[model samples]
Target: MNRSENTATSAAPAKITDSGQFKRSLGTWSTLALGVGAMVGFGWVTLVGGWINDAGTLGAASAMLAGGVMMAVVAFVYSEMVAAMPKAGGEHNYILRAMGPRWSFIGSWGITGGYATVVAFEAVALPTALEYVIPLDHLHLWTVSDSDVFLSWALVGAVTAVIITIINIVGVKIAGSFQMFVVLFLFLIGFLQIFGSLNAGEVSMMEPLFSNGWAGFFTVLVVVPFMFVGFDVIPQTAEEVNLPPKKTGRIAFISVIIAAAWYIMIILTVSSALTPEQQANSSLPAADAMATLFSSEFFGNLMVAAGVAGIVTSWNSLQMGASRLMYSLAQGGMLPAWLGKLHPKFGTPVNALLVLGAVATIAPFFGHKALGWIVDAGSPMIVIAYFLVSISFVILRIREPKMNRPLRVGGRGNFGVIVGATAVAITAFLITLYVPGMPAGLSIEPWIIFGVWWLVGAVFFVGIPGGVKPGPNAEEELMEKVYARYPHRRP
Candidate 1:
């Protein structure tokens, strides 16, 4: 196993100075909000009926429960690694430490691809949602995959993308504050839905608890990983947190539990509020459930407002995460160094944020169908990165037995290996779920998306100067050289 880049010191530890570094500002609670906000995206609002219909009520909840357990186990691996490292590039640093630059590129690329998908998905999701709220019947400029791209609808998402991009580039502190406020609103809306369900909705409406047995269960299981992807964003922004390193990691764990419970409760409440026939007939079950149970259009509108909040939370955090991961790759000489440049005053990754912004703004032009397929394609890549991080954790345990861990988990030797092996086993199984011909096999369109993305990633991998190597300071040494090029950079 390769030694970690963090394990380096010839003379009392190097100062590790750099012109572009993030300011530490986030506390544990704010950090938790960020993670929870990302995980609980627009899916619950729009897709709850689909999930329940596919797997039935109890089966869907069971699948989510299993998926949540898998994610929690993966979070344990992340908790240990983040406490020990607490660096900017979450999986990139860990994979580089255990594997090498080549594999690290693969893992980093995987997550970057995933984050980019969510960013783009939210761009179109915003517009599609507003169409529901306002009922846009304008003429579309064109059509793709049977989805229209009307000027008014596209403008909503594009405008949101630009606004979100600017908010991120201004600074992390402002962004973090906004996240906390919106997440609280999201919780309040959630409580409204649950209370309405309890007061007027019928529990007897939740029939056919198990549908098609295991086949139905795995269908919901396949999408659960993507739903839980936001928990790792906590580690991606590890450098900016004000809490102790171990606590930052623990916040990630807590966020996972909260998000998981949030989804299950959403499924249960939606089930109670709508019968199977009503769910099938309704377009947005959660929102309609709100209006139906309470007999007020205002309640449905509030649920739509919650959907907007989900969009903001997911978009804000993912744009931050994607930019930082790109910045990290650039910092390490794996990407163009210019993309790594940070604002001298704001301390945000301006160039990186712009790159994602441009992509997201243009994605609405492609219509919602294509972007939905892109998100599905990117989901597998994210799992690949998670699997690699799990591998890195086990390797680090064996290689750096004495490394300092502020919040160490598992036992020494065999016990630690058991924890890592369990994570690896679970992640690997999730990866297989994406393969073709399986019960949870993805469609051919997503496969084409996967090929195109990896091909682009390969191009950048070929441009790195020193290539892949095995050593303690391989990435550290390479990144310092990149930093050397812009010695006196200013805002």
Candidate 2:
């Protein structure tokens, strides 16, 4: 296979940043673990099952397949961008290079909100899941009553936030290793579920093809994007990868392939094991499906334990990745400078972690029902971000025709990858609006909160200094500053 000149050199030890705080310690498998850990939490357990129940097995599966395909196209485009720039800021860096500093700043605002919101969502999900396994009616800690479910959720979120912060501070090596373990266990549990259900053969996978029609199909389409969000996160770690662009792109492709197949198995297993009525009404569909297949008390409990563990692990990784991205953006002057400070000894952006924790901790009290709203608001934000990123890819290809692409998606002359990705972006945006106010039977007033948040983000992008449009002279000055700090990284 052909390789870029930097390919061989990339394997050499990565030079540490001047602050001596950031370094690239991740390998291919470690990168894959990061992607898996970010995407496979509560969504895999409750979200996917709930989705299947809403649209029926056929509609859910097809939408997931479609979403996965769309994400794959995006992965290809994103991989190409990261391979070229390999910066820690991920989408922020990509947008700046392709669109301009101003638009990139706008992109950073949305990306920051997405990461923070999702992390908070994950933190709250853990305690909510615990209510299923534990009977804590009268427990009290530090004069606080756990009786108020929201209080318990806040406490859990706080504790998990601390754990994630500590892990990130200790360094990427430790954090990445923990993520690897989480992914391994999650994969084992998922596979066990798929095989155990497949063995029963009590239900047919193809019994109903598309029972929900376009309405059902669109509902699933909107939710499936949440499940496949981790692939894009791979680019966020570009600067920390041993082979910045090439290795990052290759590992991302592997991650998408692995995650897609795993998610499909989950859909199939759940579909085969649950009846229509059981699926629709069941609170925890995957766990219920496993129980039906096994008819064993031990396995039933195992499903709950595995599901909770998955949520916790996913919560941890998402927070870590998101905070790091925010920290990177802040250092570039796209955000408040205070957000960029690293703990003197711990080597972490502890303040940023605290900020993210604050957002997530308070979110649950806003009402778990409101999470749907946050998600709805976040959905359009991501779609808009994706649209820009994809457009950036095509523009960059034209602007930098001589630029090296360590991994290109289509043939020499074919723009199918670009065209297809753009089409998916449009489709995803259209489908997303259908579930804007929440589907029937669900109250999603919290989306208003996100709507307000988006407006605030817009203001930040336009109001802050060096926040946007660094100007032509400023770009060169900024490059000289960045290079002076990291002399080892100069081309």
Candidate 3:
């Protein structure tokens, strides 16, 4: 192997700095917490029952493990990319460098939609989690999709959204610290459940380990990607991490491993502690399982509180990711340049934060019924971005073989190519799951939402002057045009 080809060139800096750069305040542990906190959100509390029902105990755990493996491959690709070009927009920088501006816009937009939807989902999820602990008075404010919209419930989500947004705007350190504290509590709850399950759970409840055969397994596998989606948040905020590039890359991969273990543990704990009939009767099976295992309702309520903590961690992290992506797009001339501006004091993307924050705050007003649709709609988009990034990984490996990779996957050889190729194949397979008639195909509503989002993206794509052309100078050209469009943003 040529040593010259192994080191990064000056063209790709270890740290990307500009007049409007973000504050590098996130340390190693904080960065890891960002990814882990985002991954271990409220889904486990509400979705564990469905996972058990669809695929039984071992089946669901297997699917989650499989999904983790697939995502781990993808994370390896991200690890190299982020290590090589540690920038604010994770996939944006990778895609742009490999495939140029047009495809970069598509990939960035795909992830932005994915992150935004999750932010909105968490906004609504917060209220839903609260309702489990303290029942809200229904001041009926209309309905959507047959689910009644209530003022009191919606207000809880909306207010939390505002507070979370403020926390982010205050600074990344504040948000990262808050995430670490909340994630610790979540881990404590997880430990309690694991210990309780060991003490009181019966193995008989785990019967029918593979329900409905392949169909059930595929159903669980399709959503596994979504559950493991948060690990990528590390790449989005790569520019703000106060750590070595290689360590940052390692954290991304580690987060995926932690999440895999977390999901598997949750499945085993839930299944062992509750019978099929018990799970069927309970809306929140994980909480019920904790309650049953500990023989106390307080533990169940404590589990619900953990779910709320999950919501906050996820909501805060995704908002940070989505805003940085928007800021990246604007800086690259894919979106309005004004969105690229950073706050002088906080060094955060205030304008972009406000825009996404506003969207999240309004999400609650539409009611919780749209949560499912938002998730399904966002799934394909997230996978699409992953697919494109996988392709970019291969492209960069072949095109810039000597490019510096602080945390190179598979070492400096053809093995890295094999890893990238595997990622491409896996993401391609995941994409097909969303197509109509597939075992894990999305519903018509999500399809419609997916179509509308792309259509909107197309409109923005057309609006760019002269359109973005793929080449060596694509980024520079795009930035030049952006500066021309918004002179005040020129830096």
Best by lDDT: 3
Worst 10 residues of 2 by lDDT: 9-18
In the range 271-350, model 3's lDDT, one tens digit per residue, is 99998888888888989999999999999999999888888988888899999898888777678767877887898989
| Shift in Å, residue 23, candidate 1 | 1.1
Per-model CA lDDT versus the true structure: 0.84, 0.65, 0.86
TM-score for candidate 3, residues paired by index: 0.95
Residues 1-491, candidate 2, lDDT per residue (tens digit)? 12454343232212223334556677877788887777777767676666666566767777777777777777777777777667666777667756776677666666667676787777667777766677533333332222244455557665776677678777776778888887788777777897788788356653565666878877777665567666667777666666646778877766766777777777778888877667768777777778778887567667777777677666666677677677766665556656766666655666677787677666555445556556655655555666677777777566555455666656455583566357446645644454537442223444566678767767656643442333222334444454565564344
Candidate 2: the clashing residue pairs are none
Error of 1 at 218 (Å): 0.9
Q: Kindly report which residue stretches of model 1 are placed more than 4 angstroms away from their true locations once superposed.
A: 1-19, 465-471, 480-491
Against the hidden reference, what TM-scores do the models get? 0.94, 0.84, 0.95
Question: What's the best-to-worst order under TM-score?
Answer: 3, 1, 2
In candidate 3, the residue pairs with backbone N, CA or C atoms under 3 Å apart (3 or more residues apart, or in different chains) clash, namely: 5-402, 8-404
Of candidates 3 and 2, the better by lDDT: 3
